[model samples]
Structures are given as C-alpha cells and as structure tokens.
Target: MSAITVIINPYANRGDSQHQIDAGLQALATSGLAFDIQLTEYRGHGAELAEAAARNGAEIIVAAGGDGTVHEVANGILRAAEGSEGVASATLGILPVGSGNDFAWGLGLDKGVDLAIDRLRRGQTRIIDVGYVEAEGFPAHYVVNILGGGFDSQVNIEAHKIMRLRGFAIYIVAVLKTLVIYYRNPHATIRFNDETHEFDMLMTFVANGPRLGGGFIAAPHARHDDGLFDICLVHKTTRRDMLLMIPKFMRGAHLNHPKVTMARAARVEIESPEGFPSQADGEIVGNDVRRMVVSLVPQRLRVIV
Candidate 1:
C-alpha cells in the first residue's frame, strides 16, 4: 500500500464545507500516513485528480465531500483501473462533508471529519459492487450509490438551484417545488432478465447502495455488495398521489404503494419515447437521454465502511 490521495470539494454542503476540509487535511497531515491532498476547483476536477492519483500509485483515494464528489472520484478510479492493472486494487475512502452524503450513509459511515478519519484508520475495507451507466454523453460513469431518470432527475436538477439549504430539507423542498410544476410520464420500455415491461414511467431508480438524496430510500433493500441493483419504478400517478407519497419515500415505504414496484437485476435496459434528464449519486449527469444501459460491476471497488 502507498500513500493516499484526498480529493475534496471545498464548496460542498452549499459552500459550507471549508471547515471540514481544513480539519480533515490537518488530521491527515499529522496522522503519520504518507498522503497528499487535492482540492477540486471545477466540476470534473475531482475525477481528474482521482484518476491521476490512482495511476500514480495511490493506495487509497479519499473523496471528502458529498455524493457528487464521491461520484466523480469513483468514476475516475474506475476509468484508471480499466487501463492500469494494480490501480483497481486501490480502495476508496469517504469523508461526508456534502449536504447529501447518501452514499456514505448507505455504507454505514457516520458523518463528521473525525468519525470518518477514525473509520479510515480502522483499516477495515470491503469489496463492493458499483453501478455502471452507458449513455450518449460521458461514455461510461461508475455510480457508487444510486441513479435515476424522469421525475427524480428533475428534483435533483431543481435541488441544485437551491443555495441556502442543505441535507434532507432542501431535497424535501425540491420535491414539493417539482411536483407543483413538472409532470412527465415518459413512455418507457424496461428490459431485464429476459423479461420486458412497459410503463408510463414517472421515475426510475437503480440503486447500488440504499439512499438517494440523503435519506430517501429509493431502494430500501439495496446492498452494494450484492452484485444486483434494487430497482424502484414509479408508474404514472396523479399529482395528488405524488404529493401524498413524499412521506412514504422518506420512510422508504413507497414500494408498498400501488404506483411503485420493486425489482432486482444485474443488467437493465431502458428506452423512453421522450428524452429526459438523468442523474446519479446526487449530481445531474445527462440531459435528454432517450436510451441507457445500467449494469452491475461486481466487486468493483474496495470501500472503507
């Protein structure tokens, strides 16, 4: 094992993550571990730094922000591993500094700089499954948490415009705001396991881990090491029904509703008549995507739990 590379988004948590970044860096500096830190300045910088560091012999790549930062770092590591042999053996560490540390919560990692460091120092790591997406833009993206299209994507897009709130609160607001104006049930065909299903799909969630948008359990039983995605498909429902189901999502009980169905698959193929927005791990990744392939990458990355 070599030193670590910490990729941080200082503007995470609504630009309130600087304190956590400073504390994490200071702790790493004095921890007697050979390590270097990189602060991301732009949107894709975390991915770039992560890939470079992994290829250059970083043993562990730490993403010290929210799910977006982790998403970029994971994508970077996966890209590098595809070209480099030993790079795939590198582990991933997460310090939950972002507003929605959805992936971190799914991994059972507590939020806060000191707690994250303690878990990292404990040296317990596990090989977990990651989700892979194929679409028009960004040929491939590795998702450590969840990915979604349609209504869920719209909520994330709206959530980004909110600058004052953090965590579950902002997401709650986004959902309400989105329901007021956005309503789209794209004609969708989903195929998995030799079966084809059609729906007027309002939203679809493919989860590697459990949480999406902080605590909304899109797939309540999703597990990262399982090598299969727990899928949540939302069929067309009335505006009143959608509004009433917000609390159900918070409790992860939406699957019991008539409009939602849960399934599992190693590979998922989706085609929709209307191109719509798509997001994964809390970051809006693509727009107007009419076709996509989601597959499970088993034992893709080692993560400290």
Candidate 2:
C-alpha cells in the first residue's frame, strides 16, 4: 500500500492544533499504516511540503490544519501534477483542526478529529470539484469551498484583524462591524453561463461547497462533485434587512429572502463599475478591478471522506 504524509499547521485553531495532530497520529498508527508527518513553519510552507511529498511518491497527502493550510496544500499538489511526468495524482485528505473547518463541514466530516482520521485510515476517496478565481491584478488560484466579493470580503479582512477570537465569534464581530462601518452597494454586471444581469449588489458569492465563516450556510444546496457552482447575489438592501437575514443564514434559509438571488452555473464573470474587494477560502484577493472570472474544476480532487 502507498504511504501517507501529513502536512501540519501548528498555528491552526488558535494554536491548539498540535493536540489534534497527536490524536490523529495515534489513530493512524493504530490502523497499522506507515505514515510521515511534517510541520509547516510559516505561511506557504504547507503547500511546499505537499508538493515535495507528491514528488516523493506519497500516495496520500493530508492537510493537518485549517482552511488556509488546506488551500496551500491543494495548490502545491496541483502545481506538482502540472510540473511532473508520469505521476498519478496524490489523494488529498483533511483533518479539521481549524477554527472554521468550513470545507470539512461541507464534506460532512465535522464529527471530530478521531472520526476524520478513521475515515482517512479506511482509505475511502471521493473525487470533488474545486473553484478558481482569476482577475486582472491577482494571481490565479483555487478555492475548495466558497469565494466572495464585496461585503463578504470586507468581513474576511475584519476577521483577520481580530484573529484572537475563535470561530463564529470572529465572523460575528466582523459582520457587525462591517454592517456599522463598511456596508456599501456596489454596482455590478454579472454574467454566468451566458446569461447577463446587472444589479447593485451588497455581495456576490460563488460557492462550490456550502458554509463559510464557521456556520453561515451561504449556499445550503452546494455539492462539491456536482460539476456546477451555486452563485448567490445579494441585492442592495436596508440595514434592517441585513440584520434580519443573519438568523436566516444561521439556519441555512437565507435563500428565502427576496433580496437574495441564487443560481447554479458552471462559470461566472463579475464586472464592477468601480471594482470590488474579493476573497476566496478566507484569503483576500484583489482591490479595485474591472472584472473577475470564477469557474469550477469537476472531480479535480480525491479527498478523504
């Protein structure tokens, strides 16, 4: 059988991820599998480690951190595949030790560390789709879950500013702050799957998998292997409407609101009259740009459970 290499992010989950790693390793060892573990030292190190493991013939490369670590590792594996010859793709696995673990939640892998590790040891792999964002100023990259523009990106920016908070609190505080300080309706023209529409949108999210920022089910019906994306556009609304929608979002019922528009497409392009801020997988991208393209890569990854 092929060996597994786990790339760990020690700083995940407010620096409590090491304990999870210890538990995960114990479970893997109990499963009688030969595996190796590598800890990332800084930003982008996990991606580099994942690339090295893939090139070294690892059959499985597990991301042992949060969403950022997962994103970096996926990028590394894809980069390695693009640069290599005659190498089969390495399967990707996640042990959710991050604050949000939103991608894990989408996979129904939010049970706990032991369960996630057990699934990994069982070696069940499923091919899932990934999303990519390309724009004028930013580098093209992949997003395994949701990508956001406008108000949502501002939340991500604010959340990072107060990283000391954990999970939903970070997002909740950021949302309140954004609502009070930075809420703006940006005029945008969106084209998806050949249909074009214009609106003054509060935010636009292209979702491959549901949920972001811990528990907000931005796209409740998203399926990662469906070969399509759920595009949600929130029209300009009153602050009272935004406040009322928060509870609905917590219950994954925000789509019922009249101001929220949801559609499924294989590709989407957003053009803003004065540009907008955007974020993918909790990473900020772009400032003021004319256009942004979002697309999906179906069954592009084999993930553990």
Best by TM-score: 1
The residue-level lDDT of candidate 1 at 130 comes to 83
Give per-residue lDDT, candidate 1, residue 102: 86
Candidate 1 weakest ten by summed lDDT = 82-91
What lDDT does model 1 reach? 0.86
lDDT score for candidate 2 against the true structure: 0.85
What lDDT score goes with residue 53 in model 1?
89
Poorest lDDT segment (10 consecutive residues) of candidate 2: 79-88
* 199-273 per-residue lDDT for model 2 (tens digits): 998999999989998889999999998999998999999999898988898888988689999999989999987
Model 2, residue pairs in steric clash: none
lDDT, residue 106, model 1 = 87
Q: For residues 1-305, what per-residue lDDT tens digits would candidate 1 score against the true structure? A: 35788888888888888888888778877777777778999998999999898888888999998989999998888888885443276789998899888888888885588888887777799888888789765567888889898898999999999988877788889998999878678899998889888999999988898888876888889998987999888999999999888888888988889998889999998888687789988878776888899988788788887
Q: Any runs in candidate 2 off by more than 4 Å, and if so which?
A: 83-88
